[model samples]
Target: MKAIIAGTTMPVLELTLDAGERIIAEGGDVSWLTPGFDIQTSTAFGSGGRGGFMSGLKRMVGGGQLFLTQYTAQAPGSFVAFAAQLPGTIRELAIDPQDQFMVQSGAYMASTPDVEVSVGLQKKLGAGIFGGAGVVFQKLAGNGTAWVQLAGEIVEYDLQAGQSLLIHPGHLALYRAEMPLEFASIKGIKNKFFGDSLFLAQLHGPGHVWLQSMTPAKLAAAIEPYLPEKSSSDNN
Candidate 1:
């Protein structure tokens, strides 16, 4: 199979598969492919598979399943498939890269044992102040290794064992869940005043750490202009 990501921001992924090759995607994430394809979301995802009246009504009538078919078959056996599960759902598509097949997610993370990631603050933050920002720290508990993926460019800092690196919350995607985290004060008053550079989560590492280039803030900034305007009354 051969795959190519075509178009600019909001790119389309084209996959060419040989005979007997298949590609699968979770229900809602089908947008990663073409515009039109059948997406079968399950109840486990709160898609109304076994929810209350309002939930089922919301899902079934509000576009029962998202179906689209603008895909051009690059090769035979290049079929797309979907599945529903009660417990574990394979929302990610894993394909063999050697066969020209490519599987990509909007954003995802992977971690190994001996790594721990936790919220930096002892108390929950108010949205008014944090603005969707939350500090997380990554650390190595025992001797082990792990890796994480971010959406955009990642700036990595090298620290010797027991040394730690502080990073902005927007720059973080996922880290080892076991790492201990706490809200620590900024060093200098000047750094704290800058806002952007203030109150970072400290990641202590005997393990590896990764960050993404694209962040929710960056994404919202890029697309906000294109979003439909809301009426002043709607704000009420």
Candidate 2:
């Protein structure tokens, strides 16, 4: 199996399967597919499914299952998973006939014809506390290779065994599960206060650190002015 991410800005991830490999995404992420590949999205990702405000409102008013599909065949025991970063916690598991599942921040069971899934959680630190530092979490179970898609500029930091690196929080995406994560000071308080530098999450590693190109705050700033009047008022 091979993977290639396409497009610019809002790029798409394409996985090419060789006859028997399979991929899983939520019901709403499918855009297009060919015979050798399949596409689905996380229920919490993209503009639809369980993640969008409008979509959630719709689900609450009218209860039903969302449909999803794959463009290829699987070897019967192979599985893949996809998810979106969600606020709060996940409470249930929702899966479609095409081997897709939706997970929250809680534990769920799995069975045949359904891809096994588990949810993980992270605490949201106030931006004032960590400033430019970003928090990163990793998949502790499964195949140890989880793919995370983010909405910002991403920078990769290469590290050697026993080495350490510091990065702003807003840039982090995912890292190796074996790496240790912690918060570290940015040295002098005066420098942090004066904008000379900011606090960072110190990663001690022998692995790769993935950072996103965009941040939630930056995205909110771009969309704040365009929201409907009532929505804008709610933010205030």
Candidate 3:
């Protein structure tokens, strides 16, 4: 299968498959497709082996589908496309046996059949429980290419050994497995105004990190005021 990411600012992943090739993606991400393709939903696993019911539940909490959708091409010249939810960029990463990436929860889009998507957990309780950032994430592993979407614009930084960067939790998009990540407390009165010790993601890296200009949480907050307010009568 040959894949190309077309467009910027709301990019879409277009895949052209040869006979018998397949691709898997998250549920609700499908935009369009061509003939000679079969879409199947499986709760076990997307790549190979078995991920039982319990595993599927865990994956759902990690921000993926309980059942994944697979598109298999029955003949050559078949095609499929998946679109990102937000106005941002779609990125492709090649995964080798020695490489694994920690994707922001809900950021994964699609992947070649050889890739496996699973959960990644943050060991730190500060970010996991106290902070609003997610503790579970979609872990992309195996030897294949995986696609992910970042909200709004994307920024990348390569940090040398012992180098660190502090970022708001909502802005983190993706980071390499080797990078050190933890939550740090914001000192002083700003925490009181915000309702808690405003936490930041402290990334100490000898690897790469990606940040997004817009996050779902931030976007919702921005537009919350314009949304219809709940009325007392509606509670009935």
Model 1: runs farther than 4 Å from truth?
1-26, 32-40, 43-76, 79-106, 109-123, 129-149, 157-160, 187-197, 218-236
Order of the predicted models by TM-score, top scorer first? 3, 2, 1
Model 1 agreement with the true structure over 1-236: per-residue lDDT tens digits: 55444443343444544644333222353433433333333222222123334443432332232221123334464543222111111221221211111011123121121122221222333353235333323221222222222354445444456777675555554443333434455755445345543466666754444555666556777889999999999999
lDDT of each: 0.36, 0.43, 0.79
* Candidate 3 backbone collisions, by pair: none
Better of 2 and 3 by TM-score: 3
The backbone clash count of each candidate, in order, is 19, 14, 0
Model 1 — which ten-residue stretch has the worst lDDT? 95-104
TM-score of each: 0.44, 0.51, 0.87
Q: Per-residue alpha-carbon lDDT of model 3 for 1-236, expressed as tens digits?
A: 78889988778889999988888887678899996677888876544444667656767767688888888899898999988788999888988767778888889898887777877754443434424444455778777889999999889999999899988867888988767788887775255434556768898978989999998877877899999989999999
Best by TM-score: 3
Q: What is the Å distance of residue 149 in model 1 from its true position?
A: 7.2
Q: Tell how far residue 204 is off in model 2, in angstroms.
A: 0.9
TM-score of 3: 0.87
In candidate 3, clashing pairs total: 0
lDDT of 3 at 170: 74
